[model samples]
Target chain A: MIDLQEMILEKDRLIPLLRKLKKESRLIAPVTNKHGDTLLSEINNIDRDTIDLDRQPQNSLKSFFLPQQEILAHYSVDTTGYNFTAPEAAKETIYFGVRSCDLTALLYMDLIFSKPAKDASYYDRRNRSVIITLGCNDPFANCFCEATNSGPYLDYGYDLQFIDLGSSYYVAAGRRKGADLLNKWDYFFRTVEEEDQKIRYQLFLEARGRFNRNIQVSHACHKLQEEEVAETIWEKLAGRCYDCGGCAYVCPTCTCFSVDDMAIDDSHGTRIRSWDACTSSGFTRMAGNHNPTDRTRHALKQRFLHKLKYDYQKHGKASCTGCGRCVDICFGGVDITTFIEMFTRDAS
Target chain B: MNTNFIPATAVIREIIRENDTISTFRLELINKRVPFSFRSGQFCMLSVPHCGEAAISISSAPNALPLFDLSIRNAGELTNAMHQMKAGEQVGIRGPFGTPFPMADFANSDMLFVAGGIGLAPLKSVIDHCLFQSGLEADAVANITLLYGSRSPSEVAFTTAISSWKEQGIDCRLTVDAGDDSWHANVGLVTELLQKELITKNTKSLICGPPVMIRFVIARLTEMGCASHDIFTTLERHMKCGMGTCGHCHLDGKLVCVDGPVFSLEQLQTMDVMELGT
Candidate 1:
């Protein structure tokens, strides 16, 4: 039996491993569909599908743990009483080729759902899912995970991780399940040699150099905690914000949600929890139409403060993963990187 | 789907009409595996079948087991639907969440409760708990002073319980913003009532009202020599999940559902947010 902790996979063995992963469990990977948009989607035909490792996927890893919308319970009311039944169990699936930024974001999400009160549904999906991450050897233009100390090359937060080598892939197991996968498919992996270790260390250093060095995520967080930022900065950010809620929808760490009970008929229905954004005016508005942060600027400030400052105070680290997905997707041009630039410009 | 978001069934035992738009509902948990117990100032997510849910405070004190009160006003969609709900109908309920009032701290202090409009709901729980305690717990409180105000005489909640509350040795003072012919009592704001009343050195003031009313009351209490630490208030925000997981109820990293719905002036001061304006 091969030691599953660290192993090497040849370029020729990649297709066989993919075929095995697809047949064993539900496999989701980054693939460009017929529409020419690359997304993390289920692989039905392994032979036809091509995985995209060049760029970060458009969507984050949140959907696998916390879905955009899900039914909490099925309810029925009659003359006797009310009855509520929990939804069916989640299916076991494997998410492959996830980037280090998403893997780190998953860790942040795990903390949010488990602490204070356990979200059973989130844990259910999380427990059943297997994550196989891919190391970022060539970082994206907007990528700055190094600033948050979350990625580029992750030390942890995956069952298995793959660091790309020219002729072969350096595979390492971070969990028991990953070791089990290697044990099951022993023919695909060879034991790591001394030369492979030297190459891995060299690749790690080169990957570190590829990130944007100007971004200072931790410094901005420190400045936010020390003193109040100017209101003009918030106003300027708010002016550009259209309140489209796209940033939150695309955000990996934003976990705000609202529950609604939809009726099937007079007697039966289901209660659903859908993704809700804090940037929206109606998020904090009370029943009597009393809103504390009524202005768009106030909401904008609240979002950044929660991400950059408030989360640091609560969790001892900022919530942002520096994936820069929001930077790439936000239509209003309200990005965290820009805010960090503005914050560090005059304040710190 | 999270089982934590699933609400247990609560049967409405009694619906007491407090006013035209507001009513006090007494609910009993039908399928509770564990006995439900909540202290005063904690709230529950009250949901109508098909309408929606709102974070409503538990109005009744801790004495009643299983059965609790939620005084709701016809303010928005979910609340308007709740008002239309009759006794014997079923509604969804989760929690008794948020930080409870500091009952232990106020044990030996002279209690001053200042309430305005629907803000009186949560404070009523604290007041009832203080007055209706058994044995040494009852004697722990020096005296109970309740200053309640509404928009009009007709809008006063818990009218039926007022006489009994007074009989139980509570110094209940009623006021209205503008009084009608029937209202022979004080025809001024509740904060003005604080001027005429004398506050002792050993007093702890609990104020709950509209944001404007709360601000003025806090100002009055400060002038009356009440320390910021001794004054407490309950805050309200739109909440979907009563648990801290949901970020909707967050007031500058402090999840109102978990960290507070109840916070002292000193506690709010420490949270460096502009809206709190500490």
Candidate 2:
């Protein structure tokens, strides 16, 4: 058993601890490119890589775990017989600067994939990885993580959590891996002084007040549970949505996928699983030309309800992390923030 | 890769031409050592290498071990490919997934089986199970009525089995929307047959068919003193992974693949929304 511990790391020792971690494990951290876009990617050269601690990355941590497409099995069919082979195991990696919202999204995803039936590939990848989350001091313009209770600051659900404390960093261990990380770099992390603890509390309060958006998502969540939102709101959102599925692709908790077999030769093939979205018409259409949720309005309603109401009822929490990526990436402005406003606008 | 998404190989033992558009493929697992079993109303993801996969309901009862049946209609790309394939051909199968019809709960109750067109495919397994595999003498149960309907006389499926069904003490009643030169049975909608029969207090209706027919049958049943919970039906949705991981078959809070292809009217009533051919 590991006890929760908090420590202080001086600004000058930060790079040294990261350099030490890079020696044993593949490192994935937030970095800003020449285009000024922040992304979470694998970094080999720790000295040259510009790790961005200030901004949330352009994508969630799910892509590194559950990729866009992956081979489930390889198959060969001939006149005599057929055979199947499962894919090889994944590598060990540590995600270094995950945001609180994205970390919360991962927690929700873990529950979904593991429940009812164990998702072998997802669990395999998830088990081999470690996550280090960074609390938000400066939220983005569209962020509403506070409304969803998924961040500004997350007290649990990561291997390690980092909070900026002016000249040094305040680090807390959330899991055994985090404790191990602190022990590995004992020379860098000093015992948490009283002053450091005071600053940590002050900074957390400051971060909570810094959020730009104040959307009341929980209010909408309750309203959605009681009754349906007006059909006109769905129609309006559907009119703008091109069914591009960008929102789901950017959503860390949306884990829907499709599987298919691609033949390499007459006797050989590979079964592939790829990301899929409910926004598409083909998602619910049966082979017999029957579609229960045929209209775009119904599809849009299904998506939002799943995020806001249905998941909450099933899992005891809403699946949306309010990461604001859907707002940033969606061309149609059909983000969760917009839906919440519309849903609660007429609530009694 | 996930093993749940990987399909096992199954060979087509035989094919029964049910109609112009539908065929029943009798399939057996290539590796007989891998024991597979399924109850009525469950479905599987059938795959044709290089083509794709579709969720096809099982048409054979669970007692028919070592071999199962999938009644498919040549409606889409993957299914059309399935229809073109011949016996001894190999295909990928991943399942025995989804909720099965509540056989134990409805065992002592009177069963009213309603099927329309190819909808009879899934219900056929339940009929076979109750009539043949229930370990009870024929007519030992309270009641068993089968009211099946098709577009026309020529389009009817399982024509040869209707007489055998009658011999087995199953009250098999057939209807068609239109009549032909050689036709001499009930000539009207399947719901019209309901008026000629008596519904008992403990009758459990097992219905499957076109959305329109199901909607009307449900409405008629509800009007005639049947509780919403006693009326059961199967819902069809697009599916990739038959397990709950895939979101294609999700309907609000329910993942149709796992939560149901089989649902009671009471269960649907509690859902956020479900299409009823409106």
Candidate number achieving the greatest TM-score relative to the actual structure: 1
Clashes of 2: 0
Per-residue lDDT of model 1, residues B58-125, tens digit only = 99998976789999988988888888888888998888799998888887788999999888899989
**Interface C-alpha RMSD per candidate, 1 decimal:** 1.8, 1.8
Q: How do the residues A154-241 of candidate 1 rate in per-residue lDDT, one tens digit apiece? A: 8876889998888899999888788888888988899999999899899999998987645888999999878887878888888888
Question: Residue B134's C-alpha lDDT in candidate 1?
Answer: 31
Worst 10 residues of 2 chain A by lDDT: A287-296
Cα displacement (Å) at residue A45, model 2:
1.6
Compared with the true structure, what per-residue lDDT tens digits does model 2 show for residues A29-66? 99888798889998878988899998889899988777
TM-score of only chain B in every candidate structure: 0.95, 0.94
lDDT of 1: 0.85
lDDT tens digits, residues B1-278, model 2?
A: 56766778899999999889889999998763367888899998887867768888999888786789999888888888888999999887888899999887876788999999889999999888887654775433477899999999889997655677788788888999999888898999999998635588899999998888888898899889899989999988878887887888887688888999999999887775454543
Error of 1 at A86 (Å): 0.6
> For residue B71, what is the lDDT in candidate 2?
91
Error of 2 at B3 (Å): 1.0
